[model samples]
Target: MTNSLPTESELQEAWIELQEIHETYLLPYEVKIPHVDQYYETARSIWLAVLFYYKEEQVHKDVISDVCQRDKPGLARDQQVRHLKREGWHLSGKGGYHSLDPFQPSPEWVTERNRRSGRLGAADFTQLKKFYGNACATCGAKEGRPDPRYGQDIVALQHGHMDPAKPANDKDNIIPQCQFCNRAYRSDYVFDDKGRVYAVADVGPVRRASRQVQKKIYEWLMSVFG
Candidate 1:
């Protein structure tokens, strides 16, 4: 027996087969495998069981038992468990497990996942700008002009969630924020009654152009003191 895990295509086929099995025998009835002490109802649990069974043929009984018993057993088992849990399985009873609910990502998770995948493309940015009208929600700065002090784009809008904890890609949840305001808000800055944003703590002197300024200073010193 080989220790190799199934390919993605094989895993997908196995998942489909597991789904079919779940629908046919598990969904309408409470089915339990004899000597296994675990229910195989949901597609996720069924898939895990199948994956574990496949590995059982390749590995020692002690290894399988350890994997089934411990939470963080080893790399292979841990990976399988994580995959199953992500697909909505949960450990249950004294031994083995069950998938209680289907996988449903929170809005925040979806938004983060989309961000990671670069799914918020040009069209999405356009829509965001159109919705918010190219101004920072906090400071009301218009888009495209450079910051006077930083020399960075002041109004270059950034996507930010109204509620960072429950972030969503929806127009209502997202807003166009200026780079300064975005940074300020992220650093726990709060607006005063006069609408002036203040940082929670002193951030020390603002950073300046280092190498360019140094070169310019050197040139000025050479021209003056030469």
Candidate 2:
């Protein structure tokens, strides 16, 4: 039999279930992300668990480990971050600070047309850039300001709509963004040139303690296990 990919509905259902499980069981601790026990294992298992959770399929740890090894090799801690950045995986920080960038998987920056496609004109985008000072809201590095070697690559961030476009912008709808976030996720009308769309409420970061590196680890862990 040929293997079949999951339908979008299946994926959404799985993601919802994963969040439900996390909320009911693990959200209380406010310490560690549930399901991950050891540091190395935690680092390794997080991504596969999220893949399975999002794909709504049973997953094997060996396969997960193999993928991590294949993609990241000896560098274990950052594999999940790379995965999210490359694949637009739907995930979140299990603890504080997702990464030094605070925006992982980068695709989360694209805002979906949700019913508000009516309001997402060039003006909205311009206002957004102005509000964030034309720099990455998460990183604060403006265009032309990133390392010279990185050039545009350094400041090529995008805009993330605070609320899904369906509800439309009501003043609190704008936010600065970067390439490290997931784009409009699971939403129709997300254009190829525009980038993928993600839910703003689901991905936004708040004030917290952990330093940059520690937060990066925690954020990478969320990309994996969540």
Candidate 3:
């Protein structure tokens, strides 16, 4: 059977309802995707689910599921949603994303999912800052100029743990810099304290350059010049 797509008006109205729910709820929710593309797709699906569910109240749940099942991933990847009797993201029998417990905090749901994925805990900021130094590792911006609005540096520095949940707190693992730089640059491969490597985000320069190569080059240069 052919799948049905929502009309423009329906999509817009549903999105508005979803927006209201998001504003009211905004609590952290952890998402899981073992692969890179799957992760992005999951995020998109969540967004679309929110946009449509608010308007039709999930009347189109069957159609949506059918289309997804017929597509590349088929029914296997699709999650079997259940009404969140105790938390948010409850799937009513109607079968669509619904925000029943909008105000209820889903800390248990978030923590449990992240723990399963091995992505728990925030970065150890104190230790992380020492290794990378208090400057934008990329742009080398230090002591940024004051901002008129916040009465602080326009570039407020933060300890950017390469991985937010799985922080290394290592000199190489953490970078001290403003939010802009951290968001832009820190979303790449970085070395943890144990010399292990990890990818932060979906940015270019996927892998980090070898420290061994750098050390050898520096040592050779020192021997030649000094």
Candidate 4:
């Protein structure tokens, strides 16, 4: 009987076909196919090989041999590595490989870190929600309402950091915001002479309101009092 072992090209073709099938049928129907985990593992191995080649700066044959345990022909391996590099796999730094799968701290560690740093806790979240009247500070969208545009439930009020990159997690740096406004604001802000903070228009996602909601509220007050 002739040998039935699959060739490298055959394996690659099969992977492509499986991906197409997943995209066209499985994803749309939300159905899981048999041996799907195997398919995922195979795809991950392919990506890991590419990442290792870039991070290690070794020959494709050496990388693939290490990853796949089989000796691949030189030309095929070279072409594969070249394709990965072209698809944006260039090394950024000595430790750039860590960017592929950054380490995530466990939930317990996160809670302990937050506690040590005085980050908002469950009680603080409840108090903040009450202080904001359970509505978005910018949009006045109430909690539990369905967002008109997306049909998703309005995002629970989030505590936005005045400086997201180096958040202080203090009352002075935190404000209640809707999901839309929080995402749009993203880390861009400016402080006025009086120490009031405002979102920076040029650097952040485009302003969500046509006019300042806070300004409109003040204008209404001035009109009523006068």
Error of 2 at 196 (Å): 21
**TM-score (all chains, Cα) for each model:** 0.27, 0.23, 0.27, 0.31
Clash count (model 2, backbone only): 24
- The candidate maximizing TM-score is 4
lDDT value for candidate 2?
Answer: 0.42
Give candidate 2 regions above 4 Å deviation. Answer: 1-123, 147-152, 164-171, 181-226
Which residue segments of model 1 deviate by more than 4 Å? 1-123, 152-154, 187-226
* Lowest summed lDDT window (length 10), candidate 1: 30-39
2 or 4, greater by lDDT: 4
Give the per-residue lDDT of model 2 (tens digit) for 37-133.
3222444244534364435433433444444454346754334443443333334443321321212223332332212342333466765565456
Off by over 4 Å in 3: 1-3, 7-20, 28-40, 43-51, 54-61, 70-72, 75-79, 83-87, 94-226
Residue 220, model 1: lDDT of: 88
Clashing pairs in 4: none
Any idea what lDDT model 1 has?
Answer: 0.46
Hey, what RMSD does candidate 4 come out at?
A: 17.1
lDDT of 3 at 92: 44
Local error of candidate 2 at residue 205 (angstroms) = 11
